[model samples]
Target: MNKFRDKLSTRNTAETGVRYEWYALQRCAATYYREFEKPKIIWGNLATRASFTYDEKDHFFINAPACMLPTSSKFILGVLNSNLISYFLKSICAERQGGFIEQKPVYISQVPIKKPTLSEEEKIIKLVNKILLLNKRINEIGDKKTSESARIEQEINKNDEQIDEIVYNLYGLNKKEIAIIKDSLMK
Candidate 1:
């Protein structure tokens, strides 16, 4: 914890425009968030460039800001990890000189969040939960490679694909649009 504290600066983050003390508030504790390196390459390289978990021990994230939501983390994570959101982000976010999209607070706050119906929410949450579970298993599996490891990997892949499908449906993207997204992601 001392190592994390030592890196703190006197200045507030330009993107967030809030002082570090704000994060100390109780409301900010249960947060999970991710960061994107650049705007331009976000859609081109990865569908979602987000961190999976937060260090609850520290109670705050440094360098990378945590996102707080009234809804389930899995629901938000599913959207953040989707290619559809990537396309949305690229269309609106500011591009950095390094040809990357700056996923700062100001830009990310502008993302068009769809108010999913209860059934939609349930579907997304279920897929995200499965993905998280498989990811946990994969992380826990060190050098011990068993048939189980492969099975976990397969489940992860399948869940990821399902999440993509759900995201596409949520955004009402047709096959052609999804195809374009797929083609762009391939590049």
Candidate 2:
């Protein structure tokens, strides 16, 4: 009987990928928390350490929201939001799909719901607009930084050439001396 049970459990365990497990967990967490009268609690899964390729037709792809957290951190958050029962169920499903189980179940429990009131929903829209503005600002800043860096680099190169010319004129160093000095200074 023990042998049978062990075989059954092992068979059950080989079923789902981390991607599916994470998708299910995210859906469940979102649904569960959205119903709360207070704040709407949001949970997310940790980012995958390894990359997996997916067919675009198989999944919905949106330009990730500016407010969304990075993938690695999101996975940890998902683990925190998940319930033990839900986690176990997901594990069983994953195993059945030939996916490996986590050594320890990781999930978040009982996060306070923070559902926004109607007025609050309006505020959230406004916040999203702000996020858009912030993204634009970030791009502009990055462009400026790149331009400044390039300008500085050009100036430095010009200055170096001038210094090399001066040194060669003053010391009458040979081509090899000049080349060695320039290479040593650059390094």
Question: Per-model C-alpha lDDT, please?
Answer: 0.61, 0.34
Candidate of highest lDDT: 1
lDDT of 2 by residue, 10-70 (tens): 4322333112332122333333322333322132232211111112122232333111222
- Give the alpha carbon lDDT tens digit for every residue of 43-158 in model 1: 12221333233122223334344433323356777777688766767676666554456565565567676878888888988987787677777889966888999898888778
Which residue runs of candidate 1 sit more than 4 Å off their true CA positions? 1-58, 63-71, 94-100, 143-147
| Ten-residue region with minimum lDDT total, candidate 1 | 38-47
Model 2 poorest 10 in a row by lDDT: 47-56
Model 2, CA-based lDDT: 0.34
| Model 2 stretches with alpha carbons more than 4 Å out | 1-14, 17-110, 143-187
What TM value does model 1 have? Answer: 0.61
User: lDDT (0-100) at residue 111 of candidate 2?
Assistant: 24
Candidate 1 positional error at 2, Å: 25
TM-score of each: 0.61, 0.23
- The Cα error of candidate 2 at residue 175, in Å, is 74
* Residue 118 lDDT, candidate 2, scale 0-100: 51
